[model samples]
Target chain A: MTAELPLQDASLVQWKPNRDRAKLIQMIVKVISGGFAAVSILTTIGIIGTLIIETAAFFSEVPIWNFLTDAKWTPLFSTQQFGIFVLISATVMIAFLSILVALPLGLLSAICLSEYASPKIRQILKPILEVLAGVPTVVYGFFALLTVTPVLQFIIEQLQIILPFIPDLKIFNALSAALVMGIMITPMVASLSEDAIYAVPQRLRDGAYALGATKRETVTAVVLPASLSGIVASIILAISRAVGETMIVSLAAGANPVLGFNPFNSVMTMTAFIANTVKGEAPHGTTAYFTLYAVGTTLFLMTLALNIFSFWFVRRFREKYD
Target chain B: MDVNEPTGGLEQSPEFVQDLEGRYRLDAIFEFATWAATAIAIGVLAWLLISVLIDGLGTLDWQFITSFPSRKAERAGILPALQGTILLMVVVATFSFPLGVGAAIYLEEFATDNWFTRVVEILIGNLAGVPSIIYGLLGLTVFLRLFSDITQGPTILSGGLTLTLLILPVVIVATRESLRAVPDSTRLAGFALGANRWQVVWSHVLPAAMPGVMTGMILALSRAIGDTATLLVTGAAAFIPFSPDGFLSRYTALPIQIYNWASRPQAEFHNLAASGIIVLMAVLLIMNTTAVVLRNKFQQRS
Candidate 1:
């Protein structure tokens, strides 16, 4: 055993010192990189913890029942009422209207790009769509408030003469914001849906063509159904984005938190409420201040649910043609 | 070409001819509708750009670029906001790029198949989908309040840190994708050369993935530059008459300045807002173009 130990020591002595140094450096790199990876996990914890702690503080002052069931939201005023539904209704309306605009346009654009457009045309159109996607939401806010709102008001005025039932469009109405937000999200929907459509195998298309199906019929029937999960996932993601959208709504959708369904009315969305209120000097620990976190918790939960469902739906229902 | 003709030796019924014509008509209509949808989408973008350019070009003189925000519309400029935005980009890039790239390298190159690694990957994906505003809430609580002693309230440092967290997931994902694209043959070759794992990654793998890493970094920075909500929630000042002198100094960004100006009731301020948008869009265009160019160059080389 002693002779074997000496032989092992002799082998160890032959090992270069630089190799140990290299190994030490590698270990340090691994530790550093691992720490960096942990930051994201820590950040998630930070976001959830921050929301919970502040939301708990908010609920301590105002009963959860008042927050949920109240008809009014006037936390900024002396006569404070906390009606979460008032903000949620407006948020949902805008998101719904925005989706109404985005779905048809986005899906059609995806169909055009994926199934119809030549490769050259696809190359040209894709970047144009990307440019649309890349525009800042704050810029969309500017466009909505300044340009789209005026045009919408003019159209509403002309429509009033014929229909007579249309309400007067407020200068700051939900329709204008919804329309612009729809435009903002259209590119995302188009791109994601295009990916889904493109993933539908060529054999499927060939099979449909062999069976005498026209391009439109095949797309509507076969391709769309085959890629339904991905398309739905994209739509859900867009909805989540619209729900979380802040700048456009805050700038265009007015600051009145009313519980109603009229798209023509000036309304406040959840994100807009948080944004506008934070702009004011609501000192820390105040009920008004805590309201931001409470509202944020609601927004976070909503988007989280949507995001989770989107990914889940994609995994659950993804059609494996292979 | 006549629908009534039995060209293929099969008898053509009148109903069949009519149905074929109807299908062709429907196909043409659907085609036109798709084109129209694409047109409308592009048209909105064109209109936005044209209107902003028409209103902003006259205001985007050298004087406007150099001067600071003022109460008077005639003399007001975006110098402070522009500087703050540039500075904030620097801070965000410096911090997020290294951390994101490192995390990506760990996950892609070093991590073994384990529950912790799986959880980290999943968490990163979900974090990317979280709203920018929630990150703002996080910044308000953690950086502005919890770390107030270090951050000195809502300064550029706090805002930059908030944005860093917001975009880290994007960067990590992008970097991981690029690293994954680097063929395993490269690593194998390095290993065959008796190089250690870190040496192989540092010398060979990382250089190959640098182009994509840079593209992702630029895109993340562009997102950070245009982000107003997070900064607003982090208490970025509306009227910073002076430029941000340091990381801890109070600051305002281009988007925040634009929001402030656009929200006003005055037409002159709206014009100023358009000019700010012009500047902001210009910056974004340059970054995006550079990213595209880099990606194309790398793709061609490979």
Candidate 2:
């Protein structure tokens, strides 16, 4: 309201003719943006809604008992088996195998990055790890099929001579897919756990050192314990990633719907099953079409559980270092 | 921590010396283990890059990049897939960038911290984590049912819309982060000077946050380019012999084409898949480098 005001448009008078118009603009912008934010919420609802509708159609024909109980998954055959457990077991087998490979390596690297490396070293190293995650799942799938499997088979061949009890490994087997998946997911685990580990209070480490504990002892006993929730969340996130992994397993795991846990055998995961179903032109409303949604619903629930729990841990139990 | 360490070395008792030896050994082993893990990860990356380049290098001719699919693997090329990929990126960017940025701006600047804000935050977080394949299903069911007349069923528009939905959370989250980085004092200063919320955000905050938002958008589009599963479910054809003529025309992307080619039993197709991969990675590298440079420039400025 004064001539000395710093703003360019300022005047001695408070009369700006379009000020009311600006107020109207503000309301429109806010309301319109509120609608835009709702789109994401709508997307989640659409996913669940579509899956539930189609899954219901699927259940009407096959009966829920058959889906929940049957042990075979040959939907294309005249016999028509729809065993979801077979798909789940294979999915779990790969997820378990990948987690086994990823968890220790990822956690250790995270510890190293946070505890041992300087800022300069971490700057160089963290980007290199991110590059691994940046590579597409499609490329990783190609790598598994082309490079990892042959390498795995060669190793198994060598190992077979020393340990004859090792079964004959198929070219397209769970081991190769799991190995590549673990590599693919390592960055996810490491970056996330690094945040958790880095958040641990420095005073805690100083206290451990004061007690004459070694660096190893301090990291394991003090930092890891303090950041346990975050570490577990990272693992859960990695597991979800592995479970939702489609291309790697689809390309390398050889889509045989088997129920056993042999890593050397060819098996189909739930994601692979959904993808394989879509490769063909299944007519709408057919058993084949409905199968995609049912399988998708199952996969959705699995990843949703993992994500929900991980998010809960991160929000609820993260150690704040002030 | 070392700065905070005690001034003198530990007392020179025999027990202390013994403990020091044990601690030193353990420290060496821990260091070795962590280094070895990093080494293994780096080694795998090196091997993957080398192998893809080696397999693809011989086939990287102008003819291979610009021709259509052929029965003979030697004659087949990635023209349609590449074109489709570019077209889809354009479509997805056009749809998602504005929508995502708007959402982010609204959430960060306009919404008061309340239950609605909290729900929106949690919902977006969950969306960010959903698998790509599920989005494919959503596209198939929702777009096919509602927007087929507009999107032209199973075409590039449909596939592009699928990716748009899939990457929305990624963009929103990125924009929100960059928007958050624009210090609140700037917004307060604008408000104190009588600018409205929209004018303050538009003229001040977004301009400052442009580089970050642009980087996020480009990276998200690059990610959409390599997606195979969602588009496959959205009915991106495995073999679109012709380049996409429009958003409604038949289309296939580099990743889907590579998946198709690689899955074939023939050895030659596998090599073509590798070459396609090299092209895809090159596209991504260019985009990624641009983002990195933009971010570096922004970093230098601030």
Candidate 3:
């Protein structure tokens, strides 16, 4: 609170440093502590450096245009196409599906836990939902491939009879991966939105009720609008999560890299592309090996953009009720 | 506003009252939707837990736990993966806990709220959101490449260091929260007794905050254990038939191994993957339960 001072305090203070010796020791302590804090900055630098150098090398060999415009990504084949979107389009499709499920379920659940539930009920349930988040993405991947895909296949088969136009469903389809990805991200959405929901002042609700608003009307008209920015931030962050999610998509979403609109068709995501491509040893400095860094850079940029926006929203727009 | 004379003044007709009923019914529907939403989230968790158990419990045996990984599904074990995971956790916990706690202490207690500190804080926040796979790339190029002789390229050490980085931001955030929970009066009291800032923080604040810090540490390790994309990208050996010998040795963790098995076309491998998940979940459960208990203790104390 007193940090506004230009110099050290001249006024009488209750506890003052005894001498220069004490001041020296304090300075040393501060430097060491600050040094530790600077490690994160060092980490950021290292990450950027690694991504840039390798991505540069990859881009030098494969022009930037092909990385964007080329529809086919066959880095391993004799006839190669360096189109990155072969992976991105599929990634976007799966992420889209995940957000579709996550938004409604996550937001409503957050509202439910924050608004509708009694304190006792909320205390019991919130932790359980958190545990859902704690379940590993790898385990979710296993669930998607082993359990969800088969179920989707069965349902698709039944649907195909009526809508014979339905394409043959692949076992490693994007739909199953997207579904479980939605579930995996649900806690992120629910917990974040719950915080935003909880932060909406009780007085707002009380005021609405005094104005003869029903429970639904009070929540929708007062609490929801008040916490709109926080809720939006939660969703954008959740999208950031879904976009970067790897194991679930890699395991369930097939490695085919088809640039198609069909969710039932097997397609590879950028993460999946990076993951599945590495099982076979590509010689060092080869284009195939360098592709990893290229994809890594793309994935990093996408997430970084989303995260920066999310953080901006959270910091700038959140209403301070107090 | 004479309420008894409502028919003459403010009384609602049957039509107005019916409109009110419509809103009340909608409110009731809204409540039920919220309840149903909560139930659906819970229901998914229940189904996930039960299905894994029903499928996995049969294969989770002593041999499965003790023996090394094998080509045959029946003989395959998690010994190498378990050892690697433990080793990785050891590296992460040992190295990161101090760094993270120190960073937190620095941010909370020592540093002035300057532009540099603000930048550091913002960087940490962004780092937390960066995808795990990018960290793997960083490890590959930085630790594994720059310090090639040290890490010996894509071994347990590289993976461990990568994980250390991955969990650092989280550990910092957790430690800061715990430190903040230590009331200011404690610091004032320590200084009143002629304790220096470092002394007060080291002697009083840290000890008071240790349980919450430990809880955060365990949760961080659990998170590191579940990670796969990073390990895979860092070249975790998918088929290490023998146990890893040291930090420099090629190794696999539980998640990587599970992913390896799950990706295989054979039906039996899927079952084996399920069994591996059971083990991973068991460990996670213990760690999380401990964390929860410690957190509750910390909450009670404060």
Residue A301 in model 3: lDDT: 94
What is the fnat score of candidate 2? Answer: 0.73
DockQ of all models, two decimals each: 0.80, 0.72, 0.69
Better of 2 and 3 by DockQ: 2
Winner by DockQ = 1
- Candidate 1 vs candidate 3: which has greater TM-score? 1
User: How good is the docking of model 1, as DockQ?
Assistant: 0.80
2 or 3, greater by lDDT? 2
By descending lDDT, how would the candidates be arranged?
Answer: 1, 2, 3
* lDDT to native, each model: 0.94, 0.90, 0.89
Local error of candidate 1 at B226, Å? 0.7
Interface RMSD of each: 0.6, 0.9, 1.2
Residue pairs whose backbone atoms clash in candidate 1:
none
Stretches > 4 Å off in candidate 2: A1-15, B1-18
Worst 10 residues of 2 chain A by lDDT: A4-13
Residue-level lDDT of model 2, residues B113-158, one tens digit each, is: 9888888898898988889999999999878657888987898888
lDDT of 3 at B101: 93
Fnat values, one per model, are 0.82, 0.73, 0.76
